[model samples]
Target: MKGEFMSLILTTILHFAATNIDDIFLLLTWFLQRDSKLKSSHIIFGQYLGFIALVILSVIGALGALIIPQEWIG
Candidate 1:
């Protein structure tokens, strides 16, 4: 039951982040605008680059978890 509860929480977190995709893009656009480079292409590029970076970080995190000791949780 505890495992199931954790799964539900993880799913909810994923859904919340998926819903915020546009907000992320907009935030990137704002930052670009600060430098007068918020053109459509630049904003799109920023969004793609941010997404790739996030994917890399997630992969690293998952790999790190496999190597890290789980004694704390146990």
Candidate 2:
């Protein structure tokens, strides 16, 4: 996914990081910490990414939660 920085720039910045999830979080933390130095657009971009991530996670969790046996779901 493209970050506030371009996809190429984001990929390069995370190249040495571990897994994709770790790299994404690392970069996000770095950006949030530098919010004062970043432009409004970038800040918004970061927030959007964070929100989307949360939404996706919530959806996945909801799906998993539905897998519970009906007998135990009472």
Per-model lDDT: 0.81, 0.72
Q: Which candidate is the best by lDDT?
A: 1
Question: Residue-wise lDDT of candidate 2 within 1-74, one digit each (tens)?
Answer: 44656977767767734435775685677667765677667766876898799879989978877998768756
Off by over 4 Å in 1: 1-36
Candidate 2 wrong stretches, greater than 4 Å: 1-37, 70-74
TM-score, one value per model:
0.56, 0.43
When superposed on Cα atoms, how far off is each prediction in RMSD?
5.2, 14.0
Model 1 Cα lDDT, one tens digit per residue, 1-74: 99999999999999989988888787765776665545676766877898789889989988888888988535
Residue 35 error for model 1, in Å? 11
Candidate 2 to truth, TM: 0.43
